[model samples]
Target chain A: MKFLCLECNTAMEFKETATPDQGSLTAIFECPDCFAEFAMHMNPWETQMLKSLDVQLGGKSEAAQPMQMVRSFLNQQNPDNLTAEAPTVSTEGGGKCPFTSVVAEAFQEPVEATGPVWTPEALARLERVPSFVRSMAKTGIEEFARENGHTEITAEVMDTARGNFGM
Target chain B: MKTYKDLPADGGSNIIGQVTQQVNRLQQRLASVRHIVAIMSGKGGVGKSSVTANLASALGLRGHSVGVIDADINGPSIAKMMGVRGQRIDYGDDGVKPALSPLGVKVMSMDLFLKDDETPVLWEAQTQKDAFTWRGTMEMSALREFLSDTEWGSLDYLLIDLPPGTDRLPNLVDLLPNLGGTVVVTIPSGVSQLVVKKSLTMAKKLLNAPVIGVVENMAAYVCADCGKTEDLFPSGHTEEMARQFDVSLLGKIPFDPRISIASDEGSVFVDQHRDTPAGRTLIALAEKIEAFFNHEV
Candidate 1:
């Protein structure tokens, strides 16, 4: 977890962390003496393990909202009362940690880029799936499409991906 | 070459600090609660949830502020059995408000957050393949949230209804090192006691948490029309099992058809049929539990 600059033989300091990419995370560290930077790439599983622990990469800058982990990560929550309004985060101490911006920027939701686009018909079909498993099913179908070289997701691709999902 | 111990910190991630903070939050939340009891049965279909729902209701009826946590994340039934299913929960300044039963028992369960009766609990993930690696961790985290993030607000008793399997007690002990005691449930059948004994060993010998007693559910069949009691299964093994484990046999709850009917209708059986044999036993069991906490045998 710690990085050392061989040339300078000094410990590195945490510089920044990039937003997660495909469930992976990139953290940049810089040597205090040499001013050289190094980026550590964590695989998807490692990133998810950290998320499961509910810890920020650089460190927690703000106190967590009550049930913040469940509220932020539970994909198919009961929409009636859970999504009514965003609860105000208590900022009693007001970001005293030095890595405030680093953690705030690091935890943003990952954005999918250049992935297979879902057609209206395909999306409508996906809506019929049970809300709890819909996110996982959609991820599976999209991954299947990418593996099969399907640029655009349609009903046909979903049907072809059904066998892979054993649905 | 400097080794891992030579490094000052884990590059400022401070994972240990975060975990300690979570533990501290749970401890602080539980501070207001006097006693934390876990209701567990290693055998499936032994009616652990039903016992938990009634015990919580019984305590509430006795003027104790009670809360119930359905720790069976995948198979949560305490909310339904306690008549709090589908109740809307809101976030308060302290934590997420728990669903209130008709008896005013605070209840939290995965069932409250689920979409429908048919929907199973599933976490959002990139892929379902090899989920065994992280699924258990996710469940533990969810359980932690249920413990520390619910606004229980000064309770006399917090009853946790645990799912089947001998492995569950270890998980609970990890979360609650100061778990007050455990009440193990079993049936008269030798098969049921076969599994319940393992849980007794786990709670008494392995984990060393106090074993309150053993409850023998479905000990006899109380006929509705004839008003006659008959042996439901091979009776008397539960008493022998308790003796073998050197724990008290708390009570023997008869298999009253009304208990099932009331549970299906989201009603408490003891509230309606207090004079019945099963109801009286349940009420007395609640008193025994209170006495255990008061240092009175």
Candidate 2:
């Protein structure tokens, strides 16, 4: 398809269109006169517009399939933010209800993540996660103690056991 | 938090900058002094200061326009030894002028700043501060404002009588970058000989100043009654050492009982005993020193 070159303001032909996995769309258009490759916009709105146009040009409708549920499950399981409202279904006990599963999943905090950052949000979440986990874990243990009718149980007992057992 | 730019539009406010400027000043000019000889020894009891006083006197007597700067900041013995104690520096528009010794050399010392002659330097780390004061005054931008600063004018030689050691005030000698050289003094004794070696090595390493020669003071005691010479230590250790170092042998000063008495009487040895052996040796050494200055080695 023909298009107006953004840089040289001349007529140009579309060279290629590449769709990125991370919701970005890029279109390479070559100017005939200046022989320059003019890059289109890079924001989300531009990407959405390019995708819609691709569908109108007899291109297959690239349905925005929501990310795989398991992929998101892995992401929500990120140790970065314990409060990120992740979906939960207890794998060990399918008998547990959704709320109970969420509580269990949220309480089962991962060990401190020391791996290289794979995303910006992951880094930001990492900074805030440790303290959040500590408080949530404290609340969870206290709730477990009360539920089991062991209301008098204290952190000292937990600490002693952890220390003796090499927890 | 005032920056260098916000300094009070005056030179005195920025002391560090002023001192740095002064150090650079000496670094450029230390080697330019016609004759810069630092007199020092490692041990203090060896009468290094008295020897410095008299040697400077002897040099002045030979008609050289000499200036003796007492680097012994804490224990400035030059004023008393040179018999210029309690003398106030003459001040006018120029700066503080160094007091003239009886024998013609211009003499300066920190002692002159004391309120009285009997005042002992009681400051702990007094030596360090004195050296600092000397370096500051000698190099600072404010030097032009003081009269004492003006006294160190052009001269044939500037003899610095340093505090007896390679440590403490010896670093002050490094301040005079153009220092002509050094003269190591030692009394005739095994301990003094070993200590004087340290001083010589320090002069070579720390000051990088040349050791023109070594002078053994009180090498032999000559009895006035019998006219027989007693070997106080080994008679010619200084000579042997000088030969080893390949420096000029600047003769020895015998343990003339008269030298002590003359010093006590506020008199220099060469002045009292111009015909005596000790005086003649000093004269000969002075000749050799003059020869060194003249490049007639």
Across B1-297, the per-residue lDDT of candidate 1 in tens digits comes to: 676788888767676666666677687788899999999989999989999999999999999999999999889898889898889988777668999999999999988887678777776655556667777777788888889878899999999999899877777877998789999999899999888888888888666579999999998988888889999998889888988988999999999888888898899998999999999999999999999999999
For the candidates in turn, chain A alone yields TM-scores of 0.55, 0.27
Looking at candidate 2, what is the lDDT of residue A8? 57
lDDT of 1 at A89: 33
Docking class of 2: incorrect
Give every collision pair in model 2.
B30-B177, B30-B178, B31-B178, B36-B180, B95-B146, B95-B147, B95-B148, B96-B147, B96-B148
Which ranges in model 1 have alpha carbons more than 4 Å from their true place?
A86-105, A110-167, B206-208
Q: In candidate 1 chain A, what residue range of length 10 has the lowest lDDT sum?
A: A94-103
Give the per-residue lDDT digits (tens) of candidate 2, residues A51-155: 221121211111111111111112122222222222322122112111111111221222111122224342233325454243333344444444445423344
Worst 10 residues of 1 chain B by lDDT: B123-132
- Score candidate 2 by lDDT: 0.52
Kindly give the number of clashing pairs for every candidate. Answer: 0, 9
* TM-score, prediction 2: 0.54
Give the range where candidate 2 chain A is weakest over 10 consecutive residues by summed lDDT: A63-72
lDDT of each: 0.79, 0.52
